[model samples]
Target: MTVRDLSALFLDSTDRPLPRAARELASAGVPVFPVAPRDKVPLIRHGRGFRDATTNLAQVDTWWRRFPQANIGVPTGAASGLVVVDVDVHGTNGYDALNRADRAGLIAGWEFLVRSPTGGLHLYYPAEPGAEQRSWQAGNAGIDFRGDGGYIVAPPSLRVIDGETVPYRITELATEPARPLDAGRLRGFLDPPRPPRRLPTQMRGQGRTGPMKLANWLGGESTDRNRKLFWASCVLAEEGVPYRDALEAMLTVEQRDFGSREIARTVASGYKRIHGDPRLAGKNSASGAGTARAVVDAAPEDRLASARGL
Candidate 1:
């Protein structure tokens, strides 16, 4: 179905009874599934969440009959030919970040505006044909993109908040032409990439000399910071630096930017990469007294891909 048709369907059925609204949506060829009453959790038994959504009227009728008060869940992205940019209000005030994005022209093109039960906003857009837009969350900005592999509770779906049941409501419908949101562009604006920090020429091929110097340099770096930390940790490992010392150095430099767990994981990955498995070096084992060198030849992107959550 066209985005216009979907928008009209939602606008018309905003106040309709939940079961009838769900059936109407299915009849219009929009796949839907039952969610728990007053909750967003899918109610289908042994179902793989939104993947089980269907436009089959018989199935739709059967589901609603079985769970009369169930909320309607719509799978976003190509499954329903729509995507959503969700602006959350809870922690960071997403409207502020959204306003910044709007000023940059990155948040226009929405066909429908929905008011979530939590006082957040869901701006719906048509899925760009043949392009897969994956879902992502920018927690610091309190905004999320619901694209592929995501689902949204449709209008009239009720949520229980503070002992009260409130409905997700259709707030506005576009009168002018609508377009698809460039999710990538919006993400880039929200969390712009920082330029890579280059290792000094003197440090290159020095074969593990001046491990403290490496730590000092890393302290000032903030771009591809995790991968750089991994590189430094590998160098330290090759020099037979103890695991404890390496952890101390990485934590000292990156504690402000990364969690202790992430720092520890990256350090462990680097050491393991060089040693087959990580080992704590003996205190008497010479730091910067390099053994046979293991090559660190992977490019930055490859290295980043290999590291988890970098």
Candidate 2:
């Protein structure tokens, strides 16, 4: 029901087995359900995954009796008054991201830290009452936030990792008073929104080829969009187009799965590779198209790499 109660449960259940730990948690008003042995999938067939969680002791007993090795699962968010920030280490470097977020104060106020079987971390925090913090993933950062509509495998539960059974163990508890996490703020920090791009100019007098034509070509790309955009921006940079003008033109491209931030970043990378800086461009190259052609001809390898979206 409160942080204090769960804290006691974590401490006392460190040596207890899974079935007893599940009972003690339910007795403390923390609803729980049975997950498969050494796995996260719920054992309950024909039932909603986390929605079937209940504080009923009889049901908990029956389920565990049927599958003695079942792991303990607790629903996160308001259902159990808890949420978790899962820092993974398998593919992406989540600890690096977590450390950066911690330094920024975006991932502070965690009540407890559980070391996952795969050497990842589970930072537990109290969920803010009367609010819904839905689950989300920052896969690139190797971090996942589990809130409403999500369930976590509780401690003392075993997981088969790399052909070995490993336990989810509590490694630390907060010394000072713990506070609820701001899920929305953390999400925004992880994936910040890019500002609106400057609109393309309607004038066609400056460059030999108009920005609108490039925009039309970019908009029609159905496959390998990022590579195409980067190569096109590199070509434009070679032509002495100003970085601002080139960005404006690319902003006019309407394509799915390509956000403004990504488009802007790719274009900037291309421009930087060419001009050695993103802010400066070849505004004087209007009549210097031959100069760009000469540069490309001299460095065929670089142009080839750019084409492969390097």
Candidate 3:
């Protein structure tokens, strides 16, 4: 049997015993990536600011609510699979081909699954003579390969469609042929290399300092430009620009290329007429009125400052 065949078996089962699968792969000389069960963890919803799998499972429930409809024509949720690494025996010994560093790199490539706080395991396989390693990391998790007598980990939830039990014999599954990893053909994989040292700029406003502020201001989370505008303002504020002045700068940029001053003035006047009245406070239109006031107030201040500087 080949690595592809083992992959097929792993994919086919939805309820198989993972330990048995690991042993089979080991016996076949195939390396397997394992995932452990995690409870009470949150999964991120793709393309949205919301996270699934919170304490109340609000996020998970929300995901399920939107998932069926969202993925009508596509695959939804997570997928389970394995990765095998092979070595060139003619050129180098199997162990020499993949050392601790190579195993670390493999884990780094699939770190997202671990960072998700989702329960998953990673497995490492030393390259064997006459075998090739396959490099595939995306939408998958890896198993840890450190320490002696360490076994490949598998998820108990993995199973076949008809629910046939897969045995836990590493030898049965490990004997499969290893896939070839060609450096030239796999150049694209190396394109997005990791940076050696993280820059301070990259660290700024990432966690609580950034998204948290915007999430608070918008009542829910701000979307696109709204969030950006808030963050830009924050950055400007950090750079010594007053919060109000930063907002004004953004608005000035919006209005500078207006084709007609008269039209702009007319629109401004209309807004002032409707919003200049105080009666609109504490009403259905109050939020819109406040936003308009913020923009109008900021724009003039920015323009005045720019004029003084000029």
Off by over 4 Å in 3: 26-35, 39-179, 183-185, 188-310
Q: Model 2, which residues run further than 4 Å from truth?
A: 194-310
| lDDT by residue for model 3 (1-310), tens | 4334544444443244334433444444443332222221122324322111122233333443443211100011111123322222232222222332232222122110101112122221223233222233221112212221222223223222244532221111222233222221122222222222422354445653342243233233223322233334434344443333433334443322221232222222222223331332332232222322222133323412332211
lDDT of 1 by residue, 193-273 (tens): 333364566567756455577778787777766657777877777878887888887777755435566567667756755
* lDDT, candidate 2, 1-310, per-residue tens: 7765686787788779788999999999999999999998998878987789999999989888888899999999989999999878789967777655654555656676677788777888888877667777878888899998898998889999889998887666665456677675565456443322322354234456555567777787687566567667766777788888988989988554566665776677667657656253432223322322322232323422332210
Candidate 2 C-alpha error for residue 39, in Å: 0.8
Candidate 3 CA-lDDT value: 0.28
Best by lDDT: 1
Error of 2 at 47 (Å): 0.5
Off by over 4 Å in 1: 194-310
Error of 2 at 202 (Å): 19
Clashes of 3: 37
